[model samples]
Target: MAQMIAPVASLLFSVVLLLLGHGLQMTIVPLASLSLQFEGFMIGLAASAYFVGFVAGAIITPHVVVRAGHIRGFAVMVSSMSAAALLHPLVAEAEAWILFRFITGFCISGLYLIIESWLNEFADNSNRGLIMSVYIVVNYAAFTCGQLMATLTGPESFHLFAIASIIISVAVMPVAMTKAAQPAPIAIVKLDLRKVFKTSQAAIISALVIGMVVGSHISFAPIYAVQKGYDAMTQAPVFAAMLGLGGVISQWPLGRFSDRVDRRLVLMVISILGIFASISITLLDQADFLVFLIVGALIGAATQPAYSLAAAHGYDHASENGYVRMAAGLLVAFGLGSSIGPVVTSVLMQYVDIDALFLFPAVLLAVLVVYLAIRVMHKDAPVAENKDSFDFASTSATLGGVVSPELLNEEDRYVVVPDSWEPSEPEEDDTEEAASVEATDDADPTSADEAVAEDPLETKAKASA
Candidate 1:
């Protein structure tokens, strides 16, 4: 572990700083927009613009990395994001902020691709899981600490923006000075949506819905707190932190449980719980702030693990060679849904009550429940041998996360045999011996049944047929 940590420490530090800035910026933007007196719809639009750019960047950034080596690319992206952070305070209009948000999103996505790809390159199969786990922990911890920074200064002030920019700017120094060799350029994945859907319909749908729920919560929860008359600095961070805390608490247990059963059943259970939690939040009076926070945590615990479960389910059906492509497709689907979530919820919040934000997700969760329930009735549970072990998936996971199957345990590694590789034909004597055994089995129906029963793969194949 020490050997693994030594080389990648700089990269991990850079990620922590970058996510710190991101965490601060995420909360600051919505709160600042509210202070600027922008309408709810406008605030939501500005938030959604970031995701729009994120999706585009996911598609386009790999080429940028290919053109410029990882080190140079990393510097360029961090600088761009820093500049965008500063620009937010200079212009307070929704239109200007939306454009800034887009730029920030694009740069952040590019940066994530660079950093994650580097991490993947540095990690071998031996320690990939540890590295990935540390990376996720840093992400959550840094974001939580960054949220606390908002308490140091008011969101309406320029100081917070400056701090965010300064943090992002300093993040560049570690990577820029690191002695580690730059990773090879990453290839842009060719996403086939139909193939991904065919691989796991439940996974694709769950990704979309989970994206919507999480995106809206990240972008608008601050606004919701303010509307309810809670202190933005204190209560909002607690609210956001609770979500992260819930995710941290639930990811492993829920993920481990899914590995043992049908993942779709887990998804159904989570959706039902999420529906109840959302409904509880909607029905609870504003005065019950503590209960609201508790229920928010429950909602987070339930919804946050859906993406990982869904991704694992999809991986169960995908070949090893196709893992990266399928995961990328799921990320794109999630991004698309995230881009739309804030807009729809914002409009709902504007025309309806602020509670509509929670209600919208509840309805979506209910839809997921119904869909998964129906799908469960038709499809057989995956045989244990065929299922992939679950990994803790961050909502912020980029293409790099999907590309590195080394992060999984050795037994769970998806090995894609090359299409050109074929089993050697048996020698003439061996073929005759095999035929004799087959003939003997054919002579005894009971022996054939026993043979079939002993081989789970054959049994599964026959069952499917």
Candidate 2:
């Protein structure tokens, strides 16, 4: 175990430091927007920009890594991220912050790409799942720690942004000084939504819906807590932290439970749980902070792992060779939903009550529940033996859509050739062919006589050779 971990320990340490800064920044951004008196729509737009940058990073960062290499690319991204973090304080305008948010999103996605691809290099079929599980745990733990750090200073002050920048800058050290070998160049996954949807409609749609509901909630929850009279510096951070903590605690058990039963059944149950939790939050509008926090945690427990369950369900039907592509498609679906959710919810919050935050997700979750029920009734689940073992899914939850060749088996590690691509025939070289015959004749004086004596087919084979 120590042998396995030793190579990636610096990578993991970097992850902790990076996520600590990122988590704190995630908490600070919306709260800071609110302090700047930006409208709800503007706040949500800024949040959506981050995911847009993430998707953009998915497309562009691979080329960056390929050209500059991992360590250099990682350094570039970390510098951009640190600059972006500090820029939020200098340029308080919503529009400038939107651009900064996009930069932050792009850099963070690239960082995850470098880190995950490095981790994947040290992993094989025997231990890939365990390595990724540890990565996911570290991600959530670091992010949760960062979220809690919001209490160290107010979002309105310059200090929190500076702290976030400093922490993000410090993240560079472990990765820079690491002696582990760099992984292969990262390749962009050519997402085939059509193929993935054909594999499992329930999975793709569930990813979309989960992104819409969860993404919007994460962006707005701190604002909601503040509006509910909770202190932004104290109670709101705790509220945010509790939500992640709930997902952390329940994800493993939920994943294992789904392995035994139909995953669609599991999705339906969680969506229903999500609906109840949303309703509970509404009813507890006047309840104490602790009560609201508990309900918030319940909501996280119910909804956060649904994407993973849906992914597990998709894998149950996907060809083993196609897992990377399928996961990429799912992330695209989720990314689209993540990008769209905040804008719609923000508009609703601007026009309607602040409670529209929860109301919007409640409606989406109910829709997801109905959809899962239909899927359950329409098709049978994969047999127990056919079901893929559940691994913690990071597609939409953490990694964005950053799939790489490392995720594929060693023999299968190549750029995913598109289904539409076909091999072209090699052109014949008449001059080279004639030269080869001439050389063969010169090399063996009897070759011409032997050619005539040889079988006609043998002669043709020799000529071709």
Candidate 1: residue 58 lDDT (0-100): 63
What's the distance in Å from true for residue 157, model 2?
Answer: 0.8
TM-score, candidate number 2: 0.86
lDDT of 2 by residue, 266-334 (tens): 888888888888887877756898899999999888988777787778778878777766767776777
lDDT of the structure predicted as candidate 1: 0.74
Clashing pairs in 1: none
Q: Could you estimate the TM-score for every candidate?
A: 0.85, 0.86
Model 2 CA lDDT for position 343: 91
The top-ranked prediction according to lDDT is 2
